[model samples]
Target: MKIGVMGAGAVGSFYGALLARAGHEVVLIGREAHVAAIRQQGLQLSSQGETHTIPLHADTSPAALVDATLVLCCVKSPDTLQTAREMGPHLAPEARILSLQNGIDNLAALRSLLPHTVSAAVVYAAVGLAGPGQLEHRGGGELVMAGDALDAAGFRAFDDAGIAVRISPAIEEELWSKLVLNCAWNALSAITQIPYRALHAATGIVETMRAVMNECLAVAAAEGVQLDAALWSRIEGIAERMPQQTSSTAQDLARHRRTEIDFINGAILRRADAHGIPVPANRMLHALVKLLEDRPGLPG
Candidate 1:
């Protein structure tokens, strides 16, 4: 299978390296620095304190991906619509493009651009770029693929990549579940500049988390979507499992980059208004993250 991974960050590169290892052809389209590094030295996959240098194909040009069987649109949420439009002429029509990203609306944004070839999944992995062409895997690489739209062959292709894959009958529900969990952690952790465990332990943290969760649930309900009630138990489990893990939101704000807060917390607020629902908790968290983003960092 020929796979075009549309980002060379830690998540995309790590998965690309794995598929390449599984004897499939993998091409990574990404930023200039990463392209140069992958062209010079093969992508380095570092995990569990061991580093392995793996040879893989890479390019900075969108045109380089003319023949991919699968296109993993792994760019950040805000980049989705633009990236899909850019890949419009380059994408193979038969390709199964997966918006393997953080939030739920990414696939919809892609579908609005290229309606025929987009899918969504709930990513269950933690990864980050260590350096140009270097990917560090922290944990979890499983994915729940969308059930209704994909073909059987699509499922096999992902399985061949060595990913723990599931063809979910209710993948949208799964996506919403992940969103609820993120609503609890991403903003709070980013605002506090603390890891999940520490942030959750702060004064009134449980109440705050639940407040956000309740707001999210209200919006979900008003939107006529059913979410898993057990989602909070899984959300709390993240703090227990990765005690020191800081959210990607925290990491992004630390680097002074834009967050998916608009989609995570702010999405609820937008949808609440559309659905005639009140999301005060989410509104507060959204504003707090925006304020935190505006405030300059402390002395380096």
Candidate 2:
């Protein structure tokens, strides 16, 4: 299989290298420093104290996708439309496009810009970009894909490449579940400059998470989406199991990178307004993250 990965960030490079290891021809479209590193020496996968090089092609341009049979849209939520435009003109007719992004609207955004068959993928992983051409895995790595349009061949191809994928009929629910989680922890932790562990250690922390999640649930209900029973207990499990981690949003702010508060909390606010639902909690969270995204770091 020929695969093209957009962004070549932590998530993109991690999956791209895994597929390459499984014998697929993978091409990563990333920044010049990382692209140069991958081209000079294969992509390096560092996880659980293991590191090795996986041979693959890398380029800084979307043109690298010309021969791909599948396109993995891995850019951050804000860049979805722009990245889709850049990769739009080069997509193959038969290539299957999968959105491995954080937000729910990313698939719809990409579909509007490109003619490719797009699927929403539910990502369950904790990985980061350690440096140029390098991926560091911190947690789980499994995927649940949207719809039946993707088949066993596709799953096998990716699984053979070490990236596991499953077909899901209720992908919207999955997205909302993750969205609520993101809302609960991402921006708050980021704003406070605290990791998940420290963020949860304070008083009213779990209560705070529930307050945000209840707002999300109300919004989801008004929008007529059903959440799985797994939400509450699953999120409850997070604090005890992995409380030390900060959100991707928090990490973005820490590095001075643009955060995706708009798509996450901002999305909720939009939907709440659309449905006449009250989302003061979400609105306030959105405002704080916006303030942080606009300003520099938390004060010294």
Candidate 3:
């Protein structure tokens, strides 16, 4: 299987390393520095208390995707359409694309731009780019994917690479559930610059998270997505599951790079406005993150 990972940052690099380690042909399309490092040495993957240097192809061009049978679209939310446009002309005729990103709209956005089978996977990994050509996996690497994009061969390839995947009938609800979890933690973690366990232990943190979760739930309900009633428990338990893991938003802020707040909490704000529902928690978080993005030097 020839697999290409677009926007191969932390998540993309982690999975690409695994698939390559499993003896599949994998190419990572990413930034120049990361790609250069991979081309020079190899992809350094640190996971489960062990580090391995996995040799794979890396390129800074979408043309790297030309021969790929499967492409994992892992770009940020804001870059979805533009990345799709760049990669579209380079993809194989029957290539399947999977969106392993945050937010609910990426799948539709990809389907809109590319003439290919595009599906989404609800990613449950706490991984990050430790440095150029380096990926660190804190914990959690399960994926819940849906749609007709992945055939049996594709699933088998992912399974052989040690990626935990399951098909779900209600992918939208899964996306929303992940969104709600992001809304609850991502911004707060970014602002505080702390991991989940420490953030959850802070004074008044539970109440704050509950308030944000309520607004998200209200927005989801208004949008007609019936999320799991026990989703909140799962959200709360993220701290216990990945205690040291910081949100990707936190990682972005720490790197002084752009974030997907616009798609996470900001997504809720957009829908709430459309439904005439107030989401003060989401609103405040979105604004604060935007403010930080604009003024990176500001103290939190």
Q: Best TM-score goes to which candidate? A: 3
Which model is ahead, 2 or 3, in terms of lDDT? 3
Alpha-carbon local distance difference test for all models: 0.82, 0.83, 0.92
Ranking by lDDT: 3, 2, 1
What are the TM-scores, per candidate, against the unseen true structure? 0.92, 0.93, 0.97
Question: Residue 293 error for model 3, in Å?
Answer: 0.4
lDDT of 1 by residue, 166-258 (tens): 778888788888899899999988888887777778889999899899888888877778988788888888887777677878888887877
The candidate that achieves the highest lDDT relative to the unseen native structure: 3
- Each prediction's RMSD to truth: 2.5, 2.5, 1.9
lDDT for each residue of candidate 3 in 184-279, tens digit (9 for 90 to 100): 999999999999999999999999999999999988899898889898899999999999999999998888888999999999999999999988
Q: What TM-score would candidate 3 get against the native?
A: 0.97
Clashes of 1: 0
**Lowest-scoring 10 consecutive residues by lDDT in candidate 3?**
291-300
Q: Count the backbone clashes (under 3 Å) in each candidate.
A: 0, 4, 0
lDDT over C-alpha atoms for residue 166 of model 2? 66
